[model samples]
Target: MPGFSKILIANRGEIACRIQRTAQALGYRTVAVFSDADADALHVHMADEAVHIGPAPVQQSYLNIPAIIDAARRTGADAIHPGYGFLSENPGFALACQHAGITFIGPSPEAIELMGSKRLSKIAMIAAGVPCILGYQGAEQDDVTLTREAERIGYPLMIKASAGGGGRGMRLVHTASDLLAQIRTARSEALHGFGSDELILEQALIDPRHVEVQLFGDQHGNLIYLGERDCSIQRRHQKVIEEAPCPVMTVELRQAMGEAALKAGRAVNYVGAGTVEFLLDARGQFYFLEMNTRLQVEHPVTELITGLDLVAWQLAVAEGQPLPLRQEQVQLNGHAMEVRLYAEDPARDFLPQTGRITAWEPATQSGVRIDHGLIEGQSISPFYDPLLGKLIAHGATREEARRKLLRAVQDSVLLGVQSNQRVLANLLDHPQFISGEFSTGFIPRNFADHSCLRPQVPSDAELAIAAALFYQASAQVHPASLAGWRNNASVPLHYRLGLEDQAWSVELNAMPGEVYRIQIASRSLELKIIECDGHWATLVIDGVRTRHAYRLEAGQLCLFTRPGSLRLTDRTQALVSSQVSISSGTLKAPMDGAIVDVLVSEGSVVSKGQLLVVLEAMKMEHPLKSGIDGVLKRLQVRVGDQVKNRQILLEVE
Candidate 1:
């Protein structure tokens, strides 16, 4: 049994919960470690034992090697499972675990270090006879050398950080004119983000499908590939939608890719779950992209098709077991699709959101599965990734899976915070996506006009429903006996509702038979509340009846309907406060984050669209740009200062 009994999961959120489930099912006790922010998280309560590592920040807790090692020691956990982020791919952390005599449920540190660098790994893969893209991996990092290599690799090549992944420190240079500038910028980002400025160049594939073959190995020197996944739909180089059995895959192509992936694993002597990613072009040619030395966030799609528990496999392999199945014994069946549910507003540049969960109802169906750790009253802070969970569906056919996933997305309800649910549904329903003819450029190209995720005003119909709910929840009005039984005219009640930057004036009049007439601008609506139990409501508006969910919290109305989740404020008879306006050239923190860099000082002349400050939040850096040509008037923040959302950082005048 590898002499390890209880396992400690050195992660949080969905992945931590996921690992705990598999470990406990395999007759192993599990320990959970968390930061201050996750004190009451679902994963913490689900563990057999829990420990506090540090504060909410990653560096002080999740990535703190000594703290994690101490937690494992304190809880007597002999094995540690790093769930695909933070220190999962870090070689130093794995080496530390080895020094502490703890089992790191992943590849060897030598393999992690070798694969962590794109340059070194490319050299290794090439030596192992794996097909790779033509690129530059020389040790000389001078601008002249990079520029010359860019010319040799041709225009439209990629400048990527050798030590970076997940879209950081990477750029696409389309012309020789922008090559040097892009190179310097990528270098600076890589130096700051990954502590290394080494860069690599690769010729960009215009519209290749991002596919990866999953490989598993054990202690007895065995390895196998478990099919491939299509990760074509992406935004900012981060995958959004993933599925098993790429629509464009052929049996011959799969075999070739599988063999190539096996070679990659054998080169590193890998001994755990790893992924070899590749770019597949239209001409049936493929090139190795990189290797992920840990389990992927999209591993569930692979599990769904192959009927295997990947986490279970990881546990067994860590316990010094042999390969579960050989190459010829593996089989894939049915079709599966998955979507990453995020706590972000699609209309507002995908800004991460933070708020308490007023309502949480996940859809349940025969073939639909949702993996999340959410509570109705839980507060989602801005301390980590905005990924709430994933919703995956499996069916006999692709269309069937697509239909079930779409319905699952629409039927599920999450309120009190913004999410990309509507945009995900729109992507699934797109004609190109339904036909499986999209590539990695699908989101940006199709959404150039912002038809789907643009900021939208609430329609009169939506407004009517919100007003009715607000009126009922106010508890100050009893209109059953005060109907329109006056002499000739009926008196009306007025209210003002605000959505985003738009507001409207509404008038409601109680009429006969408990019917209410709502008027806003030029249109009027006849609305009747059939039944409502505080949260879920059945309403009939304009001769149409439907059921939906709504909640009133902190003087705001949040609705979850077929259109999408919308939050509205009832500004009727409330005191107003002065605040900083966006048009005033005041740069405020978009979300809760620390100011990592202040590009300019006070009184510095700046032009519109100039990058002024870089705010680090949720494991990403956001360069705040100047909106007006003016001198910086007042600087309220400096590097390393943590600020809140909408808090003023600097002012320009």
Candidate 2:
């Protein structure tokens, strides 16, 4: 029955759900493994069977290979698909699956092992005559060796973790003076994130395009390239947007890049689905980046344009079938675009956000697809990656694809938590992006003045509508009286609304025939309610009519408007402190995470912007700095201590 009658997904969240969709569609029983924190996760409920692996921490659950193998044995699943993250590139996991007489549905363990290390892989690619970035992959990892290598590579080099991906353990050093310090920092991050302190250095290519070729190989010695994807738009070395059929790709260039990718794949004798990534410079010369030996997060873009289900291909290959098509027979179709919907605040250093999702409405229309694991009332935890889903669109041309994707992103909804939706929309609508003239430096270059990406306060008209909604919801207590009615037309009822740390006070008074006057701090605006439904409202503010998807509950209001998702807290009657921070001297945990280092001791004199503590959350390190020049008066956290959001980690005076 195509290698195995049952398949167990050794992952969680959207990827697991995505894999299950293809597996079940092919008539294979699917099993899901979840950590303690994911008992009620969407993937668990979607599977034919579910198994609890371990605690909430990844080390105990998702990365617990033995536990996963045990689950497969108990569930009698004959195959396992390590979807992207957790154990996707882990050679040990693949070896374990092989020893358990299970099909790993990926490359050979030797291939995974070789390609997993940036050091080894670079050496192999160079040996195979592939163009590669000039770098240091030497095994000598001492500070002195790294310092010497950094000098040889010159300034503006990149220090990267040899053992992992996802921008973790990566640092871009613009000067030789900062090389040694950055090496130490990258090493520490590498050790914590990937269980290895080894590193690799490379000449950082400034403003180059990030492009990758998708490759598939079967056990019968057949291999084919599935075109390429442009992933140049990135933030913090992590991809934000991706599109298939690189905008500037010509037939000759595609052939050259495709053949080089094939050469890289053949060096490892790679099998199953894999992607060979490269950094293409403005001059048209490309250098090998790395090879990802699994289905990528943005595979949907390739699939959308090619009209082939990659998971189905993996299954067939694992069953010992040849590649579905040869390289010459491969056909490229229309343009396709994709963007990650991350639970991150773009305006706040792209920090990971956590909370419950109160609403879930993905875009549903022609040529659009959403791969997600969200449900209303689901809580977004800090224990995993912040990606909530992906929005993908395909059309006849690049512009058609871009327009469709922009609408899909704006129409999609993920409430009760911060998302990068606004930034995604802004990026899609960007002139540089529309012209296809951007690179990996797109985000930093455009967002250097980050205020443009900052969350705009709800406009006066939006606030007016919000005030009306709040009045209507609260008036349930005074159902007999018309909402917003006042004894004197000159006076009105007071209200305070807050968005994050920004708050404003306003007043509302009833006028004639469904009209009201909203007096803001500096100006007054007229409002008229056209209609109101369960979760929909139509209103006109200052003669501009608009419709909004809104929700008001227990003094908390959520609305979807042109400004993105706005959740405002009604603070008029609440006796809570309006300050987002207790004081400048207080160093609080930004989110639930484990303390990696306590940089300052009690009584230590600290200056403003001095790094005090390092916290690791969602697989990334965030350094908390002193906000004021003072002596550390209290140090409440130690290394490895698990802390909650907003919990005071230290105090100074």
lDDT of 1 by residue, 1-653 (tens): 45588999999999999999989988889999999999999999999999999999988999899999999999999999999889999999999999999999999999999999999999999999999999999889999999898889997899999999988899999999998898888998899878899999999999889999999999899999999999999998999999988988899999999999999999999999999999999898999999999999999999999999999999889889998899999999999999999998888788888778899899999998888878788888878989999999998899999999999999899998888888889999999999998888999888766655887678788888888787776643545543332111267778889886667888887565446788988999999889888789898999999898888876698899753688899988866656545566888788888888899998799999999999887777888999889999999998989899889899899
Where is model 1 poorest over a 10-residue stretch in terms of lDDT? Answer: 480-489
> What tens-digit string does per-residue lDDT give for candidate 2 at 512-554?
6667899887889999888977477888888888888776777
Residue pair clashes in candidate 1: none
Q: Which stretches of candidate 1 lie over 4 Å from their true place?
A: 1-3, 476-489, 512-514, 575-582
Least well predicted 10-residue stretch by lDDT in candidate 2: 482-491
| TM-score of candidate 2 versus the correct structure, residues matched by position | 0.96
Number of the top-ranking candidate, with lDDT as the measure? 2
